[model samples]
Target chain A: DARVTQTPRHKVTEMGQEVTMRCQPILGHNTVFWYRQTMMQGLELLAYFRNRAPLDDSGMPKDRFSAEMPDATLATLKIQPSEPRDSAVYFCASGPDRGTSPLHFGNGTRLTVT
Target chain B: QQQVKQSPQSLIVQKGGISIINCAYENTAFDYFPWYQQFPGKGPALLIAIRPDVSEKKEGRFTISFNKSAKQFSLHIMDSQPGDSATYFCAASGWAGGTSYGKLTFGQGTILTVHP
Candidate 1:
């Protein structure tokens, strides 16, 4: 399965610490999406990129959270001064075309902020 | 207007029974609807999809019924088995130039349990 690979499947950090999650999207995939999953909110789209250009990130908290795709193959999400409420599983997904296309998602990185 | 609301946060069904999940969207511009299935400890996978051109689409025991006028869609799983138990999500996206594809949105999700 030419799946999207996410690094640091699990991360544990304390409040006020910086946490970064990385994803390697499938080859030739042009669209990438970042999602956050938790029991209370369910699966929510945090941000997304079309052809490595950020399209919408209004769902994400701009104060501390940031998402970037440095290149076609690598996308990163970072949180500065992480808070306990930020604990959740973050998933990375990629699509061949527009958001209407089927998105292939990664296993997700479970973050635990104490 | 970009929200997709799903009903019955949880559901339970007996073996061989049918499980139905419904979703409604306020964005009429959404032309594509897709259903995703997710198990514990895994990312959601695309289960089935439907386009606005058709009212009903069926593949095996899974079916999607779309109502363009009502702006609603539903997923029906027939002859359900225990393996079919999982969280189901309904999503919608616009493929036309009028509405940007970035409008893709997913429903809250429904947890379905099938007892054998």
Candidate 2:
């Protein structure tokens, strides 16, 4: 079965380090989304791309967080100078453009910043 | 601000019993609602969904009940099983006309534990 693949299931880095998470969306999917999950905030949408173009990144912190889709299958989220508060599970999901299509998510990349 | 709200952060039910989770949304523009089930260390998977046009939708033992006027929806699992223990999340998305269309707003998840 097709599934979204995420790399580095776990990551631990000291403060001020840069963390990068990558996702390989399902083949033929046009929409990709990046989300951060925390115990206090639940799941927050950081950004999303449609057709390899960013549709929204308003939820992302422009100063430190960046999301990009270099190609249809590759999507990445990077945090520079990561702080302890940046610790959370980052999930990447993809789906078709159809309004009702359900998002297929990757297992996630658990990041810990000390 | 949390646009979607889900209650019963955690629930416990005996096997063969019914498990219910409720969710409410403040945005009337939301036209599609879907529920997701997530197991430990796994991504949330789509369980079931309903639209404002339908009052209820069911697949096997899982059902989604939607109420447009009340701006609320619920998930009911009949004959809950031990394997059914997991986290359930309710999500809403706006229609085609709205800017947030296709961008799902997810509610805080509910962890369900079924005792066998």
Candidate 3:
């Protein structure tokens, strides 16, 4: 079965350091989504792209967090000068198209900032 | 209007029993409701989904009961087993290219422990 692949299954860094997470969506999937999961907040959509075009990123902290789809297959989420509160499991999900297919999520990158 | 509230942060059920999880949405525009199941160290997977067109949808032992008028939904797991222990989340999203389109608003989640 096809699955969304995310690199760096786990990350630990010091505060004020930069951290990057990468995801490779399933083939032929048009939509890619980035979500953050924490015990308190659960799952929150950070950003998403459709056909390589960014649709929404209102849920992300623009100051430090940035998400981009360099190509249809590659999506990256970077956090500059990370903070302790930024620790959470970041997930990448992909689907065929808007309202056409179900989103398949990756195992997620668990981030921890010291 | 984008929040989906879930009840009973945790639940315990015996094997061969029933497990119920409820969710309420504030957005009237939300037309698609899906329930996701997640085990430790894994991503959430779509278990079942339902639309407002049907009040109830059943697939094997998993069922979704939706109330359009009340803007609420519930997931029922019958004949539960120990393997069913995981975190469940109820998500709601609207279609038709609205602001909430393609964006799922998930509830806080419920931890279910099925004892054998």
Clashes of 1: 0
Which order, best to worst by lDDT? Answer: 3, 2, 1
The digit string of per-residue lDDT tens for model 2 on B3-99 reads 9999889999999999999999998778889999999898889999898989999999999999899899999999999999999999998765534
* Candidate 3 lDDT tens digits, A1-114: 999999899999999999999999999988889999999899999999988888899999999999999988899999998999999999999888756358899999999999
Query: Could you tell me every candidate's TM-score relative to the true structure?
Result: 0.94, 0.97, 0.97
- Residues forming the 10-long window of minimal summed lDDT in candidate 2 chain B: B94-103
Which of the two candidates, 1 or 3, achieves a greater TM-score against the reference? 3
For every candidate, what share of the true interface contacts is present?
0.53, 0.58, 0.60
User: Residue B8 CA error for candidate 2 (Å)?
Assistant: 0.7
Q: Which stretches of candidate 2 lie over 4 Å from their true place?
A: B96-101
Q: Every prediction's TM-score for the first chain?
A: 0.97, 0.98, 0.97
Q: What is the lDDT of residue B56 in candidate 2?
A: 94
Put down candidate 1 lDDT per residue, A60-113, tens digits, no spaces. 999999999999999999999899999999999988875466888898999999
lDDT of 3 by residue, B1-116 (tens): 78899988999999999999999999897888999999999999999999899999999999999999999999999999999999999998886464434479999999999999
Tens-digit per-residue lDDT, A1-114, candidate 2 = 999999889999999999999999999999899988899998889999989889889999999999999999799999998999999999999998776888899999999999
- Runs in model 1 deviating more than 4 A are B96-103
